[model samples]
Target: MATFNLKTVAALLFLILSGCATYQTKVNDARNAIASENPEQAVALLKPLAEEESRDQLVYLLDYATALQQARKFKESAQAYQKAAQIAEVQDYYSVSKITASLVLTEEMAQYKGDDYEKVLINAMNAVNYLEMGNLDEALVEVKQLNLKLYKYRTEAKKNYEQNPYAYYLGAMIWEAQRSFDDAYIAYKNVYDIDPNYGPIKADLLRSARLAQRPDELSKWQKQFGESAPSVDLKNSGEVVLIFEQGWGPRKESRPENRRFPQLKPVYARTQRAKLEVANQSATTNEIFSVERVAIKTLNDDYARLVGSRVAGIGAKAVLADQVRQKNELLGAVAWIALNATDRADVRQWSTLPESFQIARMTLKPGKYKVKAIGLDAYGSESGEQMPEREIEVRAGKKVFVSWRSVR
Candidate 1:
C-alpha cells in the first residue's frame, strides 16, 4: 500500500512539472513573436495564457496589452491595461499599478474624440514609471520610451488641431515629432493632396516636406500647385490720405448680362497737394495728383479694395476718411489705409469682398484735399461722372466727407 501511494504522488508531481514547462515554453515563444514584430501571433499565444488559471496572469495581461497597442487596437489595449491595473492594485503592486494605469490612460486618450493633451502627458509619465520597473526587457523599455514621445506629439497635435482645424497638417506634424520622417512625409503629402481647401495647410505641407529633406517632392508639388492666392495688402508709409464716397448700385445677381460691365464711378479722390513717400526716393515730391474718378462694381469689392489698400500702406502713414450718408451707416463699412500709391494713382482690386451696401467715414489732417465723386448704375455701368475733384481745406483732426449720387 505504501509503494502504490508513492507511485501516485510521483505521477502527479511529474504531470505538474510538465505543465509548468509547457507554460514557460509558450510564454517564451510569445515573447519571441513580439520581438519579431509579429504582434498578431504574440497576441494569439498570450490570450489563452492570460486566461489560464495556472499561468502568471499579470505578465500575460501586460504582454497582451502591449501587443494590442502595437496593433493599434487602442480601445482593447485600454481595457487590458485597466485589468492589469486592477490586478496590480489588488496584489499590492503599487509601482506596477501606476504603470498600468498610465498605459490605460494613454490608450484612453488616444481614443478621445476631443482634445486629450493633458491625458497624453499623464500617460507619458506612466511610461517613465514602467521604464524604472527593471523587470521589463530592453525592447519593452524602448517601446515605453517611444510611447512617451508619441503621447507628447499626440497632445501637441490635439492642441494644434483645436486651435486651427484648417491646420490638419497636424497629423504629419505629430509623426515628425516622433522622428519618423517617412511617416510624416506621407501624412503631409496626404493633407496637401486632399481636395478641400485648408487655408495655409498646403503651404505647411510643402514646408514640412522640405524640412524632411524631400526637395524633389516639394518641387513636384510646386509644379502641380498654382500660385498662392492673392490676399489684401495693407501698409502705411507716410501721411497718406484716402477719401471714400458712399453710394449703392444694383446687385450683380440682379443685373442684366450686357449691362454688367466694369463701372468707372469715382469712389474716392485725393488732391495733388497730398504727399507720398515713395521707396528709395529721398525727395518728398508733390507728384501726387488729385484722383479724378474711381469706380467699384460691388460694395464688397469696394470695401476689399479699400481695406487692402489701407493695409498695404503699413510703411506709410494715412490720414483718411469716408463720406457716410449717416453716422449709423459708417459703422457698417470696413475701413483701412493704403500706402505707397501717390495721388492720381490707379490701384486694382486684390481680393474680393462681400457684396453689400455700406457707409464709411474719413478723417484727414489739416490740409487742402481734393475729392472726386463718381456713380455707377445698377448694372455696374458707369453713370455720367459727378462732382469731379472738389477741393476742400481740412482742419487738423477734422472730418472730410464725399459722396456719390445715382441718377434716376
Candidate 2:
C-alpha cells in the first residue's frame, strides 16, 4: 500500500511540473513570433493550445484572439473572444463544492475563472472587432452586453468604484456614431463623473452636450476647461481618430517561499511613450500630440484584492498537512514537503494585451493624411522602430478610424 501511494504521488508531481514546462515553452515561442511581427505564425502556434480540452484554455484563448486581431482577422478574433467570454460566464455559476479540491491541489490544477476585468475587456474587444468589420449592429449588441456585464459586477461588488471609464467611453462613441446623442451624452457623462480630467472625455462630453442641446452642461464644462479642452469642428468637417495602444501588459509568475506555497505575482515592464506626428498628404497640415493614456482597469488592484482569498485557502492547506504529519511522521513530512515544492499558483495571463489604450482625435478636411508612431524609453530616447507610416482617407461628413499598436 505504501509503495503504491508513493508511486501515485510521484506521478502526480511529475505530471504537474512537466505539463507547466511544456505549456510555458509554447507560450514563449508564440511571444517570440509576435515580437517578430509575424502574427499569423503566432496564431498558428497558439491555436492548438487554446483548445477547449486544454488546462490553460482561458489564457491561450485570449492570446489566440489577440494574434488574430493583429493579423486583421477581426471576425475570427471576435469569435475566439466570444468563446472565452462564454467560458467565463459559465464559470460564474460554478459550485462552491470545488473548494474541496484545494485541500490537496493548488489553484494551478483548477479551471480558470477569469478575472472580472478580463471578462469585461473581452466584450469590449469583441465590440471593437465588430466595428472594425463594419458591423455596427453587432458592435452595438456587444456594447450592450458589456454594459450588462459591468452593471452585474457593480451590483455584486456593492460599490460604484469598479465602473470602467474606458468601456463607458467606447459606449459613448458607438452611440454618437449612431446619432443617439442622448445616450451618448449619458455615457460620456458617466466617464466624466469617473475621471473629469481624461483628455478625450472632455471633448466627447462637449460634443454630446452640444448635440443634445444641453446648454447648461456645455457652459459648465466650457467654463471648467477653458481653452485646454480638446474640441473639433463637427459641422461641415470630417475627422480621423487614432486609437493607440502601448507596450505589452502585465504577465504572471510565481514567487516561491520557504515551507509555504508559491504566490502568483503580476510583473509589469518599464515602458515610455513615443512622440507621434500626423500630417496631411493632400496639404501641409501637421499636428503633434503627446501620448496620454489612463488606466481603466488596474491589474495590481485586482491582484491585491485576490490575495486575501488565496491566503485563507493556503493557510487551511498548511494546517491540514501539519495534522497529517502528526499521524505518520515520515509519510506526512514527505507529503508536506512535496506539496510545498510542487503546489504553485496559476500564473497565466493575456500576455499580448496593451498596458494602456489612448486616443488621438483630429478634425480634418476630406482628404488623405499620413501618420507615424515611434517607440521611446523612459529617458526619452528612441527605440529605432517606427510603426509603418499609415495613409488614411477621410470622407465628407463621415468619421475615419485607425488603430496602431506598439509592443516593444
Q: Score each candidate by Cα lDDT.
A: 0.36, 0.66
Best by lDDT: 2
* Highest TM-score model number: 2
1-408 per-residue lDDT for model 2 (tens digits): 677667856864774566456345568888878777788999999998887565568889998998888887998999999998887788444335555454355565556676666777787677768867667678878878877887876787653435667667767776776778889899999888877777566677777888877888889988987833445455566766555666666555555453122333333434455455666322111112111221224444555545665676667667767776776677666666666555565565666777666666666777777867666666666766556888777666566656666666
Model 1 misplaced stretches (Cα beyond 4 Å) = 8-16, 19-24, 53-55, 91-408
| Candidate 1 TM-score to native | 0.24
TM, every model: 0.24, 0.82
Overall local distance difference test of candidate 1: 0.36
What range of 10 consecutive residues in model 2 has the weakest lDDT sum? Answer: 282-291
lDDT at 82, model 1: 56
